[model samples]
Target: EKHLVLLRDGRTLIGFLRSIDQFANLVLHQTVERIHVGKKYGDIPRGIFVVRGENVVLLGEIDLEKESDTPLQQVSIEEILEEQRVEQQAKQESEKLKVQALKERGLSVPRADTLDEY
Candidate 1:
């Protein structure tokens, strides 16, 4: 991903680099203080030179990983059938529970009623 680093001194550096030499290495641009770079999860410790690319101002950043096309996995006929059976079983169990709850509440559950009526 391309990222832009805006330094404390108000200068910005735009680049398409992964990381700096080291986690402690600071990058210096024109009129900008040494900008930190690299794997920082939270507030970067002072004197540690590792600024996350996302923390800086970026005009544009494209995810190269998302650009690659990959074929989706195919489901077998048996697997589809199994999934449908499980879904049907769950629906039946849910209806049973709903009926039981209505009985407990002293409410009459209508036979052959749609789910919306419940």
Candidate 2:
């Protein structure tokens, strides 16, 4: 069956389910990484994927008929990558402003990189 798998790191993969284990590990054939930005999306072929159980965030069967009727438009890979880059830059700018505001109030924001120092 065709399935859509979302990983912990925010990757969406679509492929045919080939195998699975008790721990939720999966083997997907003819896989592709799907990237979406707003109403546009692009798929990059990944061939086969072996996903670890621990990284699995969500999994669901894909209805082929309804999949074709999605409101989203498919864009070229180059365009999608450019959009993704812009989106990430905007997010980073907002995050930096947030951290700046916190600092202005004498509130230090904990950095994710420093969390392991303890």
Q: How big is the positional error of residue 110 in model 1, measured in Å on the Cα after superposition?
A: 1.4
lDDT of 1 at 36: 23
- Residue 118 of model 1 has an lDDT of 42
lDDT string, candidate 2, 37-106, tens digits: 9999999999999999999999999998898998999999999999999999999999999999999999
Task: List where candidate 1 sits over 4 angstroms from the true fold.
Answer: 1-73, 113-118
Compute each candidate's TM-score over C-alphas: 0.33, 0.95
TM-score of 1: 0.33
| Deviation of model 2 at 37, angstroms | 0.6
- Clashing residue pairs, backbone N/CA/C < 3 A, model 1: 36-51, 37-50, 37-51
Off by over 4 Å in 2: none
